[model samples]
Target chain A: MTLSKRIIPCLDVTDGRVVKGINFIDLQDAGDPVEIAKNYNEQGADEITFLDITASSDNRDLILDIIESVAKQIFIPLTVGGGVRSVNDVRRLLNAGADKVSINTSAILNPELVKESSARFGSQCIVVAIDAKRVDDHWEVFTHGGRNKTGLDALEWAKKMVDYGAGELLLTSMDRDGTKSGFDLELTQQISDAVEVPIIASGGVGNLKHLVDGVKLGKADAVLAASIFHFGEFSIKDAKEFMKNNNVEVRL
Target chain B: MIAIVDYGMGNLKSVHNAFKFIAPAIDSVVTSDPKVINNADRVVFPGQGAMPDCIREIEERNLKDAIIHAAQSKPFLGICIGLQLLFEKSDEGNIEGLKILKGNVCRFVSSKTEKIKIPHMGWNSVAHHGNHPLWANISNHEKFYFVHSYYVKEANSEIVQGQTEYGQKFTSAVAKDNLFACQFHPEKSGSAGLQLLKNFTSWTC
Candidate 1:
């Protein structure tokens, strides 16, 4: 069936609380990850992504509990990421109730991890989150939670990640993240067209209309945002209504 | 009692939790034992991952016969790979399937000039072909969460109970006698998903 463009509310968790910042820095407490995720579930969010921003920086056991609680209450799809290094980590997260497990630094560090995870858990459960920035006219990959810039090109990496068996790509614009300016249409569109896998456009979603633009212009299968849905600037329901009214198919 | 056939594939936790949430009184178990599956009041075969691995595990565990018996004898519900494996064979891994239904599974490719994403992952709507108890309380055009690249390309028309449009119209659900299988995941499909589980719990073949 022709799937509607998804509206995903992302919860960046650090120390078990959903945190937000400007461009992945200057962190501040937003709310309990489980509670906020439950709210989005009731509001008809298509999916929920929980990124343990400090997964590598601290103990990894913390987010598993949150994932368990959220997965129980939120019956939709739950994708958990950050600090995932191996297939064992993906197994532990899935056992804890995550429908999909996202890998970032590890996928970049060891692209074979993507192939391994996809083979073991199935490609449908593996997501490769790429944080990229526009350098001149080309997009370059970033690592360490979007702090360190990798010399790899964004489009080429996306294609490689897919070939390695990543079922979906969660592409974030490092430049526009938390800026709420809107998605990087050029970067998002470039990767979207290059890969056959579904692309979830994350970062820079200020208003409801930007969601429509992400699908209409960027060709993203889904649009993900942080501040807009987290702080109640726009409810997921409101965004779906706006998209439906604008002729962009969305779950209401 | 509902037995969720577990060959070490798919989201057994969510499927079990969904059943528990809908009908707390109903007993459910996710097991690989043929006896438990064959003895259950209802059977649900939920699957994910590659078809070849799923088939290998089923063969290694020797649960294929029990699954076939359940499908023929009781109310059976297959989800995603659970549904795909029922066909005769799949293009993926170029492997044989259960051969329960006369069909072939193949990957989704765009027929039009526009590009269509493989692994049609996300929420989408399904159009039911006929009225059935399993669809009880669920809207015909209800949206459900789906994540799959290969789908049943050919199957019996009488059994094709629902269809959905992606690159082109294709089968999304199937039903015959006591069997009901769908491409979308009901456990991950939110409220409508919960309702479908509830219907399955109370439904009598």
Candidate 2:
């Protein structure tokens, strides 16, 4: 009767290959993006997200080609993020079979893109990604793979994106990312309470309990993890089962 | 042959690919051409985005009459906004719909104490009614992917094939004669979705 909480597997891709980063550095190649995505789909991932970390315009077409092939096979919601700069990028990614397009740096650079794209495409397909890091008392938004500081309060940025017609927010803690120290509960809880739209907790999911904590403690509608699932440390079913055991409603 | 009526609003690739995956031998194409939709043995009216814009595109493309005609005569299938367009009107933009079915689309209302989000996104189970051909292989209460802000209301209870609950219980599926429609995206709902498309491929009624 009620909506089920989502468990999304994020594939960080660079130059058409899937790669994982530790603290946004120390890039490690996992495998082919297409093959890896298919594996996750088979493992019953609620949705698949492809973060194109490739900083070059030349490889944009490569990600599109990869998306095309995967879209032909996988039958789940696919979200594409990173390097999305304009409305044209949103259209291209959607045309290539992305169910949703997540905007990060471009959203911070030009908030109007969120309004314009959501107006034309509808808010359901536009996801605003806010990369945040702890700065003294509050979390500040970061851009360019968590490299540059925007000096915008993370909670304020999240509210602004929703006002700009973003249907969802992908909140990642730069501090907990890759450390697997579990999600920053305070950060996730604060932003989730502020926004009416669904929030996906990202960055520091190290185990199944961390995933459960993201839902129970953080109040996120969904949780995203990499490396652990990518490297076969645990199956997606294991995570869902664990969450279900802990009273979280998940599609099994 | 199946013609997925793409009025240029939502993702048509998933629908086209789902049909191709389930029954490759059948011919399925995403077309905006009214003639193609009218000629196809099965018609799929799939849409997303806002209802007013969807209505605008349908009118702009000159597909309103052709779609209404096909819905009356063929094994028609409508998904998401496609389902909404079949109603008489929608609260979104206060625009009128195709009026094939007698009802209006209303937005999900949440009071201060409710706190339910708008666009009820994500997966939820559908409680189907009776025995419709579309529910052949799909079990009752099977989960399906849904993303929408408005739902059909004031619809004839006789035509309601499935219902789902979010903030309130709403009609999620309907079947009138040969026309079958659902508010969920079976194309993106994994195996259950594929099976629904497969059933539609062979669905005669």
Candidate 3:
């Protein structure tokens, strides 16, 4: 009974504001990162992950201020990702009060970065984020915010990440990013089977049923969503209740 | 005041936050000092990550003696790896544990047909076993967040507060007089978790 289903709400921060949408388009400012995090905390979100999607791409100082603000205000665990390329970046983020640092593009480019950072900071602090999009009828890993295809199979990359010492896998389906259809069950199961660490299924979470399905069918340890949570499509309390009703274990 | 023993393993901030959320008036401090732990109203030992490192930290910081002393005096709560450390020993890294709970921690022996995964990581229902103040608000069959591979075995069954079945029934919560533990992250367990913390805060030992 050591396994627990995590309900994570992702905050896509750009220029210090929480922005979210499907396929990352027509983004609307949800609110201050700290404020929204507080709301999520009250709503019983198991954890909150802040994805600084624009920070590194724009070559700006990673929004330590926002992270610092949210860390100070929110009580739940905070995991920050995006543009974390080096061990130094990982150190900086952890020092900024992040409970965990998620590496995506950088880990794909340099798989050794995952091992190095995990060894230095311990694997529990390292989260390897895999952004996968269905290509040529196969799930292929993508990088650079889903703009660059690495031609690596999603399952193979996930196994490599675990070998490199990633404590957790944040698997996001790029094709389902904003679709609200549901999580890619096949992709989720593939990665979950490939790795021993906790797998957090992300993308295509439209409703509470989808979350239950992600955990039961996908065998995901946790479910991460962006647009649904950001736009107030469903509340964390409601989602947990729904999960419990469906016999999907959740913290009530 | 609740003394949260800090042995440099994982995040104590989330645990501190959870205590603050449930019992805002109950002061919580992360300290390695034996004197502070001895003087606190309650004690909480929360941990994450490997058992070997955590055990080394407890010894290095001289927290091992302090925690054992505090547990003898007041109600003590151990979360996740903290609970595993309460056992006599663990299969993880073949490390020695505090032996406070009169049990041993063993890895989940994955059956070939079951194909069950290790590091059981997710929410699972807890079946309450006995009367314990820490589980006042927590109902039977209520789910608690868990993330670990090894668990306590061969413990005094009377002290078992809750049990959960993954592949087989395992102790998810344990209580021995003033010493209490849960192999789940209550701070990360959401509202019900907060309520459990609140119950612990209000418990009169």
What is the full ranking by DockQ, best candidate first?
2, 1, 3
**If you assessed candidate 3 against the hidden native complex, which CAPRI class would it receive?**
acceptable
Candidate 2 per-residue lDDT, tens place, A1-252, comes to 588899998988888887762232222424677777777877789999999988778877888988898999889999999889999999999999999999998998899999999998989999999999999999999976689999999999999999999999999999999898999999999998898889999999888999999988998989999877877788889988999999998988
Deviation in Å, model 3, residue A247 alpha carbon: 5.9
Tell me what fraction of the real C-alpha contacts between chains A and B each candidate also makes: 0.81, 0.74, 0.39
Instruction: Kindly report which residue stretches of model 1 are placed more than 4 angstroms away from their true locations once superposed.
Output: A20-30, A55-58
- Model 2: clashing residue pairs? none
Which regions of candidate 2 deviate over 4 angstroms? A21-30
Regions of candidate 3 where Cα sits further than 4 Å from its true position: A1-6, A21-30, A41-44, A56-77, A88-97, A120-122, A135-137, A179-181, A205-217, A234-252
* Candidate 1 lDDT over residue span B1-205, tens digit each: 8999999885699898888788889999999999999899999999999999999999999999999999998999999999999999999999999999999999888766878999898888999898888889999889999999998987989999889888878899998888999999999999999898889888887
Residue B52 in candidate 3, Cα distance off native in Å: 0.9
- Summing lDDT over every window of 10 consecutive residues in candidate 3 chain B, give the lowest-scoring window: B114-123
The candidate, 2 or 3, that scores higher on TM-score is: 2
Model 1 per-residue lDDT tens digits across residues A142-225:
986478988999999999999999999999999998788999998899999999999999888999888999999999999988
Candidates 1 and 2 compared by lDDT, better number: 2
Give the interface RMSD of candidate 2.
0.9
lDDT of each: 0.88, 0.90, 0.81
Query: Model 3: how far is A192 from its true place, Å?
Result: 2.5
Instruction: State in Å the error of residue A105, model 2.
Output: 0.4
